[model samples]
Target: MEWKPLPVGIDDFEKIVTGDYFYVDKTLFIKELLDMKGEVNLFTRPRRFGKTLNMSMLRYFFEENPENVSRIFQGLNIMDAGEKYLDHMGKYPVIMISLKSMKQPSYELAFEMLKKALKGEFQRHWQLVSDSGRLTDADQKRYLRLRDLEGTEADYADALKFLSECLCRCTGRKTVILIDEYDVPLENAYFSGFYDRMTDTIRSLFESALKTNESLEFAVVTGCLRISRESIFTGLNNLKIMSVTSQACGEYFGFTPEEVRRMLDFYGLTEDYETVRQWYEGYQFGNAEVYNPWSVINYVDSCRLNKNSLPKPYWSNASSNNIVRTLVEKADFSVKQEIEDLIEGKTIIKPIHEDITHEDMDSTQDNLWNFLFFTGYLKKIQEHQEEETIYMEMAIPNREVRYIYKNTVLRWFEKKVEQKELSPLYESILCGDTEKMGKILSENLMETISFYDYQESYYRGFLAGMLKNIGNYIVLSNRESGNGRPDILLKYPSVRGKAVILEIKVSKTYQGLEAKCQEALRQIEEQKYEEALRQEGYSQILKYGVAFYRKECMVKK
Candidate 1:
């Protein structure tokens, strides 16, 4: 079989089709949009799920380019919908802009990026000014200011509206607007401590272009989250949102199961279907079981070159994934328990608020869960409605996301151990305050990620890592002391004053935790784990038997 170049990271529809890249047929998305005839459509899907590519496809199809439309989409799926659908193609003036590049460290820089992107769009449609004679002197000046990125804040806010009016006047037709990654600047601003400023700017921009603009025929906006309408959209009553939970346009974003099978078969990777399914499949978008398009393409590309290569977590490496880490670090006891349950192949029911803003993210546990669910960290297994509320039973979508959670937990714990003030824990242990020690240990355990299969080795490693800051003591882990190997030993050899020994046990159930703690203590006594420390001239010894059940731990001294 001849190898076709994969369209990895190439978001331009014209380039993908003309370059002969392996393009998945999502052209039917256009037909559906026309059939639904929404005044303004908002699609929220996880990043790298072909949102950009689909937006570009829409641009090429409807951007009033008759010559390129036939060449680009001649053999694609939407061409089969007959002339009624094809007649609408390339009929409207289109404005395409992507906010993906607006990810800057500060509001000022991000706003500048936004201006640059808008400037590019103006330049793309420069023919509206040069060829058409409809613009007055004032409109022409405003167009030049926007095209040159020399516009004021007000000008930039209303730039899209102005551009749409110009296009309508120039072409004698209303305009269709396509905005990709529309919430990126808002997300960046939230993380950079300038959310209000960015929100005001974006709200004004969208309010003019989408809400109040008369020249807009229709608009399609795509982003990772459906930001609250009140915050950014204000009173856009014509807005229709299609989130991950929405059945509309579900099959357009991610690759469906059948699509993945056909692609694998085309690549002579039919035998690796199960492996691919386990790693990249299982995301439920409405009724469609979808796979990550980015991961699947990369997996197939690598497998075609080298058959022995293993499937890595390709999607995890695409972005920083700091949102999930932040959510985990800020999780309360119940939230942490839910995360543990999800990691352990269990399901959790969460009330989902689809209209969440960046400001509402850390305000409540449910908002965080909703953010996770929309961002593809979690997937819906089932959903139900009560009164006016919708609740979803969510879990880790696939092995790749599960691996991300596991690694994120371990990395986050390691960082905490480095930055955490261990003096309180150390002092509690040294003063023989079992209550304080148990509280501190249990708090740390709650913060760390835990799974159902709480092995003794995992606990031993965790205990040893947490006790690394014991002052003036050498911490040894899993070393032979007397009759057997203890979990961890803190030896104050030079001072010869006091030492500490820990025996770790993992209980299957919370009810058995106390018995397991006592069993661990009995093992410490029977094995004489402190014999080596006693022989080193330590006059005092502190022993703790710690039993763990998931994230909860019990310590007996």
Candidate 2:
């Protein structure tokens, strides 16, 4: 197999280029971006989709860092776009700052990070000044007079403007401004109760610096969530948002399936392509089918080291629970039923938000589905263009994300049932004591588990989910209903060949209970439940019939 470079867990452009790292040619984005001619571009992607690295690549290509540009973008696709831009690159006094490091517990630490980034910007400008030994008369005048621009709230923007002007004076080009994770402070503040203050501080600083600066040629801002432009860039309306849903540059952020397959072929891991797709290939932006790049690269690295076996869930690590919490809390009766269906590998119908650049879900149940879709948790299975409706569905693409969502859902369900009396029913079912199980079932389990009146499948599903929650039993539901029907079956594999089959029937009258129970038993017998158990290598089987009256349930053995 030919050698393949896996840039696993690497997002720095300089290291990726100079260290002989595997590079994906997202440099096509530079051409696309330059085509837009937007002075202010804002991109919102979920965390860790190579936003930082893309910005770094842009900085390397356009920031006028003459020495670094030559080394950083060598053998890259941007080179094909022509070197005219490279001559202007790094010629300006670029101010690149990342607010990601400001995830401090306190606002003071965040302020410190802000100050540190500003200082770095200042030092970069000073370094350029020191390198230009013989300054022009205009440069000399600005240089000597610039000492009076001391640090203050009013001076910060002017100071950077002055430096960019100085660079244009000396290098003859306007400076490019790059701000990464610009929403970090607000995100941190949202969780920490400092949202208003942080918003105020950042707004003041950003509005001053980015709003009316003549020395700035263009500015780019990247963040996970979309903070309102009105809140931060309360400027004179020159802003252009290039969020993931935007057609202008969506292809550059995530790895399209074609790219993943091509890279797989390059590494001779094409045999594991389906497995890779199962884990990371559900993300779609318009017509583009993309995979999470971080997951793909990490999987490739693991596969390479292990001599080519596909890896599990490389992108789930970066997901945040804040949004999931919002989704769960805002879920309605329909949402709960839909979620259970999704967990059980069934599809549900709903509308999804095409543009989900925001972090939180709307407080409505229907909106939760839209939120899930936008954040990439749920995806569209089919579209009904005639009706203007999308048939939304969901699955755990990778094990990592599966684990996270499972744990989160488990925790949520656990918390809900924590103070409720679950011991009686749980113990009754575990002990295989039918009478007590029936009493507990009638008393509690039937009422507690979520169910839909119209969706009998969901009621059966709730029973299954409940059985699994009870103990280490191989609980299987909706197995084989001969005439295209659904049967609820449970196999207690951990109980040393102890297996149980439950058949449920709903009745409106007490007299009909016995008849429904008899029908359930007859169906089990007709469907050859015993034969299925024998085929499973279990000779003996315990059978039970559960009858339901509205929310009330009864079990008989």
Candidate 3:
């Protein structure tokens, strides 16, 4: 099979079009977007749901003097729309801006991003000034003045509206505005506690042009979360929201099941069908079943190189787990249980919503999980229509996301533990107070580590997290050996101190932990655990063995 240039990280229309790249024609959705005829439309989709590329496509199809829109869509599916569509393709004024860059922990940084985006759009329009045949001398002079302005610290909305009016006068056409990731700044603000300021900045900016301006032809806004109507839209009655939960435009955002099957067929990886489906094919959009395009494309790219490597995680690469990590940090009992079920790939019962209604939980742990589910982090495993509830299962969608979310949460909780007084536990262990160590281990480690029925790796990971709370340490699992490797080897390093080594084991039988610990010690000797530690320059290694009983873990000598 011939390998096509996967758009990979390219979201620019001119770059994708003028350069050689594989294009998935979604111009059909462009027709549908236009069919709605709403002056202002908001589309809320999860991260890496192709919002940026779709906006770029919109710019190619509508921008009057786009640098190279015609060439980009030359051989695309839009050609099937005939010359009528092709003639109108590059014939409208377009103000394409993205708020994705506006993501920051501070209001000042967000404002800087906003300024940069506006400046970029202004420069694009300014370049078209010479070709703007319809602009009067006075209008041209005003455009020149706006372009010549230096300080980026000025109000962006007024400048953007002035540019829109200038474009309308210059092109004799209303400007089509594409605002990608419109909620990024607001989402950041909400997450980081600058909510009011971001809301005020963006709400004013959007209202000025998106709501009141007559020079605007139509606008499309894409974001992960939907800012409430009362906050962003305000009295803008013309606004229409096309959310992931919407029946229409759902299939347009992500690749449908049929599309996935056909693409798999095209790539000749149909043999790995079930495995691929299990990982990336759980997302459902109303009646149409979809797979994450980000993951699918990445899987295809992987298969192109190695015939048997299998598709790894892709969606996780483009997303930040801050939202999920924040959710996990604040998770309640019910949410923790649900998360446990998800990690086990078991279905969890819940309601799916475009916007969750619970105020206390809206931005909290419970609703964040719901947000992740609806947005595609977790997929509905089973549905009970009679009860009006859905059973959802969660998985790290891609390899990148798996490590990211776990590592993010790991670091977060690690910082929390360090902030508190952890010296008592460390001191107790260092002093070799077996009694005190036993009590602390029983209390602290037991509840912290959870065991699954047949998940040896999970048990190891759980133990690792539990031990990490002790102090700076390295826990290695499942290392290679000639005969067999130890289950886990934990190393605790401290300045001016002797280090400790822990060998972990799982108790399959209901035998007492003392017997288990004795067997574990025997295995450690057989596995040459002492040699492994001595090679690291430790003259003496204090060995401790541990065993688990469901959620309760015990340390044995």
Candidate 4:
């Protein structure tokens, strides 16, 4: 039997339903929204946790689309949620827009892109607004100006509110606004050096459209971070925020355990449930234990294509994932120790500042932890409220997120190694200064946070990264020698030039490092590791054995 195609990158509600793709039933999110009835609702979830699809679902359910009369929401949970909830369906005009595409390099460009996006939305509703006899000549011309992208920056700021009013006049019903990834511009601007300008522009847009607009029946805004009230949603007293930590709508964003199991069972992937849970489970949104929906879908799809494929980091590619990099790069001594502990599968406690804006992101270690917590890199295992501040115990969510962190830390370590003054390490290896070489090796070893369980391969890679920048000698890893592959080999260009061989080992304990180094040296000699270099006519050859026990190292020449 063939299975329904998984919606890999498709977020459109109509497309997913009409095209018969496999969709996790999140339609109940509509019932919850209508019941809450906030003037504005902001949902804070991670990047690929179905925020856009949920918003798209909302647009289809609430928007006034008379042409779609085949019951697009037929047989969903929302349909059985009682007629009171369904009564609001197809009753309001929707001003749907996604700010996610506004990730631009400059404020001018971001503003232009946003304006063009609004122009498309205007075109979507152009016929409705143009046919409204209640709309005056001035409003019609203004709508045309916005639809053609002929409006100035100031005119565009109030365009959303103005369009909502025009639609209200057309249908005698208020408009429901759905904005996806509303914080994208702010996030992009924060990193793009235009935060203040973008903030002001967004502030005006939200102020006119959400804060004081009478034409709005309700609005739902989805984004990753909940920008502080002072930063963007200033004075919007009616804005109800359901963040990842909020217990109200947690199950609607990511997949619950039962939902995931059923999805796995549907695709005959039930046997791989444990592996899937290990890699994708552990995220705690509210009190609901959930799996990364994006990763689960992609993994199930991969299993369909190739039954033996293993799960990898799927959500990491959906976003930049540089938050952890900034956290690791700017970590202080204590923070560095905490990070090392985290890499060792330990939990760290941090003050949970849920109300954070992009401006203060990564400014301090505490803020960085909050950013990581909300951005899905870390999972909230435990939490408590003390006085007024909330403290959370967070750990790496799963292997997939751990893979991201380890990769980031490895890259950061590699960059630090590249930035090191290799003249000393190079000189030590050349002049046979094993003392300086061991010291430098130990120092560099101590600086790296290993997630590979401190295996011999990790140390080998570390040594290779350090030696890769040697001025003249070329470094080769695991290259075939006379009788065996050397852990590392660095050769000078000329036949008369010097050569060096490095053999690496991992010790069980600190005291065993010296013995392991000796064993490595014995392997180098007994295996005739230097015979190939001698065959190449290198007159001088130096050999060293390197061993590591956790952060300590031993070098023997």
TM-score of each: 0.86, 0.73, 0.81, 0.95
List model 2 lDDT by residue over 249-268, tens digit each: 77788898889888888888
By TM-score, who's the top model here? 4
Candidate 3's C-alpha lDDT?
Answer: 0.68
User: Candidate 2 at 116: error in angstroms?
Assistant: 2.8
Clashes of each: 0, 5, 3, 0
Off by over 4 Å in 3: 65-75, 81-88, 127-142, 149-155, 191-193, 350-364, 381-405, 412-438, 446-454, 461-503, 507-545
Question: Residues 1-557, candidate 3, lDDT per residue (tens digit)?
Answer: 56767777778867876776766667777777867888999887778878899998898788765276666677677678766556667778889888888888799888877877777877777756567677778666665555555443434546667778878887788898888988778777777778877887787778888878989999998887766667767788888987755677778777887777777777787887777786677666556677777877887777777979666667666776666676666665576566555554455555554544223245545467676765556655545444655444445443344444455545655565556565676676556555565565556433331324434555566545545666566656664323465665556574334556556666666456556667667777777767866777666466666665455455655
After superposition on all CA atoms, how large is the RMSD of candidate 1?
Answer: 4.0
Model 2 root-mean-square deviation? 7.4
> For model 1, how does the per-residue alpha-carbon lDDT over 420-471 read when each residue is reduced to its tens digit?
9999989988888877877888888767777535777677778888988788
Better of 1 and 3 by lDDT: 1
Model 2 global lDDT (CA atoms, 0 to 1)? 0.67
